[model samples]
Target: MRILYGVQATGNGHITRARVLLPALRAAGVEVDMLFSGRQPDRLFNMEPFGDYRTCRGFTFVTDAGRVRRLGTLKQSRPLQFFRDYRCLDLNGYDLVLSDFEPVTAWAARRQQVPSLGIAHQYAFYHRIPGTGSAPLLKWSLQLFAPVDEAVGVHWHHFNAPVLPPLVAPSPYPLTEEEGKILIYLPFESMDEIRYLLRAFPEYRFRIYCNIPAPETQGHLEFEPFSREGFQQDLCSCAGVIANAGFGLCSEAIQAGKKLLVKPLQSQIEQRSNAVVLEQMGLGRVMPSLETEAVEDWLALGSGTPSPWPDVATALATWISTGRQVPIQVLTRELWRAESGNMLSLC
Candidate 1:
């Protein structure tokens, strides 16, 4: 079957999830075309696998100083371009359309009368999951942002709903027992602020990854350019992670059984809700701001038991190959069993 896969490039989490899904689809003998939206063409990384994917300025939120700036995001959005992209996309040749909360492809599929499947963490909001800041506006945005025919939601836990576990990168690095250093990846925050926070903890080593070019080393603090291989290496060795409460990294940390200290992006309802659920599940600690007290408290708390990772990508590929007409509950149950080791007590 010929499939059109759309991925949101607003954050690394969506791209990370797509990275795993792409190979799974190909292995299943499905012909796939990729479309990426949200970020600028130049900012995308590790993108050679998509096979000449299309890009556009569909939609993305602007962030500053570790916060999602509401006003700035409104100012930066280009509605005309978004509409044009949506109207211009051609879905005639593909047998199926799939989206990871990407607006352009979803909208175009809707307009063209194509059956679209949405696989994303955002879809989990439709179920009764642990969430905070569930305002009317947030609910409306979630529904309208990426409308699709079938929705498959991914989460850290089942929450007694049709939710699957997180799709994590293959376990390439050996699990180590070192617990002195922490891996930090807060892309939205300014580098200066991160340095200031880590500088206070002179005893703990911090390996920070950012978009900046120049690398710096001072005392126990180290700044390095972003490299997927290098980041995964540090992640394997570190005892814990300090990052925004984005779904991707938090899921990866949980899979690795690393201690987590998450500071959700301010003014983002989804992130706030994710933080709440993380705390409720005993998976991690959340801070309202990037305060030193929170970080110190988290560092002292130490790591939690590792949650079983799911092979959702393979399951998804099977479902897609079979034409996505299966009962959503059955598919979710299969994935849940794989994720929770058939231990219904975890749910």
Candidate 2:
């Protein structure tokens, strides 16, 4: 089947998930074309995985100092161009369209009267789950931005729902001895602030990854350019992770059994809700801001037991290739087993 896959480029998490799913789809003998939206065309990195994907001026949020800037986001959005691009897309030859919460391709598929499937964490909001930041505008944006026929949501826990486990990169690095170091990836925050926050913890070594450049070294802090290889290497050696309460990193950290300290982005409902759930599940600790006390407290705690990460990419690919006609409960069970790491009969 010929498929059109749309991925949101706002944050690296969406791209990271797509990286895992794309290869699985190809291995299943599906012809796929990709479209990427949100963020400028020039800002993209690690382009090797996504082969010649289309680009558009799709929706994205604006953030300042670790907070989602609502007014800034509105001022920056280009609605006219967004509409024009949506109306102009041609979905004539494709058998199916898949979206990772990308707006342009979803709207185009809707306009063309084509069946579309939404594969994203955002879709989980439709179900009964823990949530925060419940303004009418945010709700409207999520629903209208990426509408789809079938929604397949991913989460860290099942919550007695049909959500699947997070799609992590195939484990490239083996688990290593704890080196008393911490990996920090808070892309939404300013580098200066991050540096200041870590300076207080002189005993712990911090390897920070950021988009902006940094000086050679501070007393106990080392700044590095963002590279998948470098990040993974640092992560393997680190005892824990200090990052925003974003789903992708948190899920991966849990699978690795690393201790976690997350700071949910301000005014971001999804992130705030994720933090709440993470606390409830005993998966990690959440902080309202990048406070030193919280980081120190998290560092003092022991790591949780590793949760097994099943081959979710393979399972989902198999289901899609078979035409996705299975009952929701059956699919949910299969996915839950993969997430839960328990071998029990699905009655």
Instruction: Please report the TM-score between candidate 1 and the true structure.
Output: 0.95
TM-score of each: 0.95, 0.94
**Which residue pairs show collisions in model 1?**
none
Clash counts for all predictions: 0, 0
lDDT of each: 0.84, 0.83
The digit string of per-residue lDDT tens for model 2 on 1-347 reads 88999999998889889988999999999988999999888788777778989999998999999999999999999999999999999999998899999999999999998989898988877666676436546546677889998888888766677777788865568877466688999999987888878888888888888875543567788778767777777776689999998888887788777888999999888899899988887788999988989988888898665665677788787778778878655877877765543421122
lDDT of 2: 0.83
Q: Given candidate 1, what's the lDDT at residue 268?
A: 79
For candidate 1, the 10 contiguous residues with the lowest summed lDDT are 338-347
Residue range 118-159, candidate 1, lDDT tens digits: 999998877776664357565467769999988888887778
Runs in model 2 lying further than 4 Å from the true structure: 133-140, 213-215, 340-347
The count of residue-pair clashes in candidate 2 stands at 0
